[model samples]
Target: MKQNLIADYLSCILFRITGFFTCFLPFNISLFMGRRLGDLIYIFDRKHRVVACANIRKTVAEGGDWRAATRITRKAYQAFGQNLIEISFIPRINKPYLEKYINIVNKDNIEAAFKRGKGVIFLAVHAGDWELSNIICANLGFPFILFVRDQGFPRLNRLLNSYRLKQGAKIIYKQAGPRQLIETVNKNQAIGMTMDQGGRHGELVKFFGREASMSTGAVKLALKYDCSIIPTFYTRVKGPYIKVILDQVYTVSRSGEAQKDLRDNLQRLAGIYEKYIRLYPHEYLWTYKIWKYGKERELLILSDGKTGHLRQSESAAKLIIQQLAGRGIKTNLSIQEVRSRESRQGLISFKPDIIISAGSSISALNYRLARQSQAKSIVLMRPSNLSLKKFDLVIIPEHDNPPARKNVVVTSGALNLIDADYLKEKSERLKRSGFIKSALSPLCIGVLIGGNSKGFSISGRLISTVICEIKRSAEELNADILLSTSRRTSPEVEQVIKNELGGYGRCKLLVISNEHNNPDVVGAILGFSSIVISSPESISMVSEAASAGKYVMVF
Candidate 1:
């Protein structure tokens, strides 16, 4: 603890000296020295350099190239250095210096906004000498309130605040709460706030196709007070010259739904930020962890090669995401289809909050991945080779009749992907594709046949009987038949069923696996059919058919 004080004092002295040198030197000379210092820091500051490179990789288009990421990371450090040196010159800036070195485009925007007397909310981000913005505004003789967050070091925060105050700007620390902001706005003073920083108490918005938490305070204030929010940014134009772009002003709706208004307004601000960042990618703060929340909450999906298992895992993941949305917990989901242990190697890089999968083929892999990543494993079926304790959550079908345990969740049938919305969507798509004989078929019968599986066998006579019964039943009910077979269906059984249903004009579709394996056939039939019939062999197929919420008959 005693060493901390000595180190802090030394750090303060170093900062003061750096400030003195930056202020004392000529603009161009100071910039060159700052860039050199940045290059030196890029070599020395290992942790921040790594972070900056990673962030650049996440945000840029060709981010996968290490060379590209490295170059950008170095430039990002240099930008930071240049910004710091310019901040040291804030006290020297005045109206005359601004006229020579600073150019504020679209000044008429703020001038017109001031005529309304509603207190404009200036939305800006941490990009390109942002400190100069407040000073320039104050030097323009506008009453401005700058809202700033407390820095890590109290002495440095004080020093920074003193510079802003000296430029005729009112400082409002974030911890002072909304009362100060309300009073300032009531006095018809412009408020400047940076909206891109991650906050625990804010809405999750997409910044660059990835979810990042954004502060909604500006949006809320704009909506509540009917204020105009002008999206603004400051960018460096060559040596010692700054260009401040004041974008078009936007007004938020008083939609009476506060949550939605807040989200939409924040989304608009985030969109503007994304645009400028794309324009000046290196000028933004790339070292900051913009996707910290997304990285923390990941949902990993492990899939066996079977279509049934993959569908089950994906459907359960969608449901989990839906539930999390209700509680305001945004999640990042990744699905991987694994055929062997080698396919699991990629899981080493991602640490998930929960790992989910279905079928016995992927149970062991799921457990291994969950243990390695320290995530909760959720198995969708009864595992044949592993103990129940190995999984954090085991969802078993009632037919298995597994022993009761704290971690076990017994479901009526297997979890399936046949939800009402999916059924409606696929059915409409198939109707438009001319696959369905009649989109408005009032009595379409679906036949889902499966072949040999655990304790079950398919025979020619059984196929004949099933086909005869289906034809007889369809005739009695005056229904159109849509029949399909699974991968497990035997060729001989398929032939028998086809022969039995020969010359039946009412059989609208017959998707024999031996001929063509159209993946959408089964889903389309299940979605559009009024009734479904399944051969009792594969539980997954039967469960999915029943989940369509039609009258399902077991043959």
Candidate 2:
């Protein structure tokens, strides 16, 4: 016992010593050390690296040049360094001090959240200096509780959590006692959670057009607590100072069947997270195994199944993976490329059993190339409505409802991920986490608008009016409101909405420049809202809200 105590004492001393040195070093020098440390961590941490590599390969091909990969590799390291440094200094980051780094972009949104009788769930992601979340909230006057997983580093855990607490956040550890989070929030204290990372168990959803698992606790909590779910995130602009984005509040309707309702709501919430990642690719944390979860025990077949069109081929692959895993058969994933001269090398080097082709694969470029590969080709989708005489099988969605040939498999829905069951599961978790609050009284509204696009305007008078009406509706109903926006939402537009809502007495208005992967805010809003009001231009966004199996009112 004495020896253990001595070691613990020594480690604490070392942390203090290092902290002092870190504080004194020039910012650049500290940043350099952070990058170097990040590299060491990236190379050494097998699990995190595996997740990271999976994320990386999805964007650029695995055969991408080492030079380009190196830059991303270093950036991952840099991000880790930034996260570490900021977290370590949590002890020193009081509200007064946080003012130097955190700039509140949507103060009124947060104020509105506090005004709600129920507690608030601040749902966000790890896009920028996420550690600053606690500090920003602390400076805003309302103290909060932060629910987080302990990274297993004993001193580091205590240090980081302590720092957040010092900044006026009650850091609730998921491992030692997650109930503390429930207790804190139940006391009407604000709870902050990151929505992006995968949970031990997750709801399978579509991300980047593929099957990805998402955390469900955020949604579950909101459902159970009858609280406001707030959408929030931070963007790293040129300055070290952060721009905190918060928008509208969200809550769900609970008509009993708590578990089923929550999961459905959460899966729908995951859809919102998917849209944000698509909108900001560079800002998205690319080094995460967003698609890595579930039955790793199933038989692994890394085949690139080809049906009709190459793009549609993934349907077969996804169906196969799930069906096999369902029978206790885990599978591995691989791409089969008989075309793209460079892709051929990758395939041969990493041979697998089956090959599938979709639209991109059966093109004129790939037609001749398939003859060169070893595996049998399965063409899924065909252009020119041609017969798949050359391929083994063809798979098509009900979209075309083409007449089936010998090897064709007809599916009703596009074989992308996400099912009602997955949605149900996610919704339940959010309820359990107490991050969700549901009500039938006032209309719960979810707002998703972001970066200006050629087809849409981020800032406009119409949008401002919509926000004002939403707030007004909440006031008239004598009900709490849940409101949220997206990253693409213009800074000006966000401000206008917040400004307009400030006059409405008080409503739970959440302004999120960043939507952490938490589904609670959006899920509950869609699930409970008497009528979901959305912008007409963003069809994808509209469809996501529709996924809840509710009445969706689009403007």
Candidate 3:
């Protein structure tokens, strides 16, 4: 608390000093200095600069270009600087000052709204020389009541409010609540309030193709009291000269259902402002997290078309979705099978919060896409060509000898979709398909055969010996066997296994991968078997068996 107070005091002192000089300087010179001040802020304020760029990327750029977002953010900073300096010149905003610098378009709209005998609600967003709006409205002979939230710095807030009060505008604190607002409306006066940055308790509506929380207070009051809502916007025509546009009065829809009516009106109001922001993005405020409390997120998965790698990416995506669900967030999942690095045209417009990929083939694509979209990248297994630091998280097997890094996570084996529910579901499907006989032996042994790997190959003789030993053990223990071959199995070894145990009574299930493939075979084998014998070639296969709690034997 002490630290915050000291910082606030220092900030107030700095603002006062700047204001004193700005008040005496010429309008154009003040604007030039303010722009320089903003440029300095853009260079030094790393935190808000990042926030601004991220906001621009997500909304205006549509997650396409970082350079464009940066340029716009820099200009936005300059505009904000000019706006801050203009606030100090508020005392000079008289009739001649208004005529010289301010141009009010559709000035008759205010008259028409008051002619309705219901109060007027001036709905505005945090955009373009907004501090001078009430003064301009008061100078135009409109009864403007500035309904404002108190700032944390008490002295600064009082200082700013005094300027508004001196311009024939009445003040209504937000905390003073409904009574004064009702009175202001009863007298058919106009109340100015902003609808952006609603904070936690706001209505969720779609803005820039994403759900953003927006304040519904303006819409709610307009609906309940039959007030005319004039969507007001300010644009800097040039240095120190602004155009105040009073948009067409919003026609409130009365559906009699309060909640639906409130949301629909708010969405329409947001749409009006979004259109303007798209046209003049540099004039709008982009320093805050626009979607911070948003409840929706998009997840993109880049697949290499290999079964093992795709499954690992899917597993990671599943865990992420679960975690997001716990936070009351909904996730939209999209899978892109990347055949080549150039196969990324479809992902250009997708704005994802996270991008997940596995296998070396898609790692480069993942890195590039994450950089383009500004999403967090997660890679499974150590990427062959890319540095580990490139990804936000790296999941590697312990056998790979992963380095000790903050982003590196070494797991015991490869990731797989093996769980009790998954096993049970696959097992039931296999049983229903008549792959598992009812009269089968109670004890079951599963055999998983994989083919060649780096510097390793399975010979036909080795398979013959393995099958003979398995036959002898099955006869002694009265156990049934479930066997499946991988897609990489050699034809010589596959034929040897068929000749050895094809029609044997103990060998109830035999799947030849080249002839036909059953997606559920492996999971079903792990689901029912007590002992599992797997070739040492595949880490993914062995990991799946061990994860199922089966006694695994490697040959």
Candidate 4:
């Protein structure tokens, strides 16, 4: 508390010094200095610069280009600097200052609203020159009250509110409860309140295609008191010149359902602000995390187009989706197939909360996209080219010799979609499709054949020997066999399997993957088999067999 008091005191002293000079300086010169100050801040304030750019990318640039978002961020900083300078010059604003630099459009809208006799609620957002609204309304002969909460810095808050009061505007503390507000409305007066940056307790509504918390205070007050709501906006025409636009009075709905009425009205009001922010991209504040508390999440999968890698990525994405769903959050998934090193397109507006990739080839792309969207990066395997510390989480097989690190998780084998429920579902589907014989013996063995790899190869003679042993065992035990080949199976090896077991009555199902494909074949094979035999060339196949809790042998 002591530290905060000292900081606030220093800030108040700085504000006083700035106000003393700005009050005397010409308006245009003050604005020019403010822009330069903003430029300096953009260069030095790395944290906020990144945050602002990320926000712009998600909304204004629609996640298309970082350079465009950076440009807008730079300009937004300058506009905010100018806004700060104008705030200090509030003491200098008078009738002549309003006439000279400020232009009011649709001044009669407030008049029309006032004629309703219930009072007017000036609905505004944190956009261009919002501080000037109260002064402008005061000068225009409107009975305006600035309803505001006390800021953290008491000294600076007092100084700022003093300036507002000096400009002929009445003040109403937000903590003073609804009685004061009710009194103000009963007097047929107007109260100005900003509706954006609703903080933690605000209502969740859709804004810029994403849900953001927005204040429903204005809408609620207008509804309860039967007041007119005017959607007000301020735009910078040029340096020191601003246009105050009063949109058509927002008609508050009385649907009789209280919560529905509140949300619907607030969402419509937020849409109005989104439209203007889209038009004047650089004028609005973009440094804050607009969707931080939102319940919606986006998940991106970076695929290298390899079947095994894609399947692993899908498994990770499924887990994440399930976890978020358990917490009552909605998730949207997008898959981008990375064909080349330069393949980074078509992710135009998706801002992901988590980015997942499987293979080494697409890890770099995953990192880049995660950094751009400010999302968490998760790689299934240890990234070959990038450091493990760069990713938020790295899952690598124990055989890969993964190092001990906080971010690294060592798994026994490759990730595959082969849980008990998944196996049961696929098995039932195969039985319904007549692929599995209903009259077959309960004792069964599953054979999964894989082909060439970097360190291993499958020969026709070797597969024939393996199939003969399997046939002998099947006949001795009176058991049925389910057999399938992989995409890598050579035609010679496939022909050997067909010759050995194709017409055998004990061989219940035989699949030549090179000729026919069944996505559920592997899972269905593992579903009901008493034992599983897999080729040593594919770790993914072996892993699936092991995960099925069946006895497995690798040939």
TM-score of each: 0.58, 0.51, 0.82, 0.89
RMSD of 1: 9.2
Error of 3 at 69 (Å): 2.7
List model 2 lDDT by residue over 1-555, tens digit each: 676656666756666776788777755566567667777887787656544544544444245333444466556666666655655465556656656666667667766776776788888766666676666776566667777785545665576566676667766667765577677677777888876666557765555445556677777777777777777766554324556667566676676897677656666665665555444433456555465553442111222332112223454677776777677746666655554556554543332224555553244333333333222455554534454665566656566666767877775544432346645665566567654433235445555554565656755687777776766766676656556666566777767766766444444445453544354545545554556676665433565566556567776
Best by TM-score: 4
Best by lDDT: 3
Which candidate model has the greater TM-score, 1 or 4? 4
Rate residue 509 of model 1 by lDDT. 77
lDDT of 3 by residue, 1-555 (tens): 777778778866877787788777778998999899899999999878877887788889745577888899999999988888888888778998888888888988888898899999999999997879878887788688988887777767877888899999888999986799988898999899899887789988898888888988888889989999999999999987899988987869988899999889999999999999998999898888787778998999888776667778888899999999999999999988878646666666667879999988778888887765557899998887889999999999999999999999899998888999999999889888886645567899999999987899999999999999999989999899999998889999999999988778889899887788878889999988999999998888899989999899998
Clashing pairs in 4: none
Residue 266, model 4, lDDT:
90
Ranked by lDDT from best down, the candidates are: 3, 4, 1, 2
Candidate 2 shows a clash count of 80
Task: Check candidate 3 and list the clashing pairs.
Answer: none
lDDT of 1: 0.80
Higher TM-score: candidate 3 or 4? 4
Kindly provide the TM-score of model 4 when superposed on the true structure, using C-alpha atoms.
Answer: 0.89
lDDT of each: 0.80, 0.58, 0.87, 0.86
Can you write out model 4's per-residue Cα lDDT over 1-555, one digit (the tens) per residue? Answer: 898899899978977888889877888899998899899999999877877887889888744588898899999999988988888888888888889889989888877898899988998888887787778877788788988897778998888888889998889888985788899888999899999888889988899888889887888898898989999889899988999989887779888999999899999998888888998989888888888878899898888766667778888888889998998889999888778645566655567889999988778888887887778999998797899999999999999899999999888998888888999999888878776655557989999998887778899999989998998999899899999998889889999999988788898899898897777788889997989999997767888899899999998
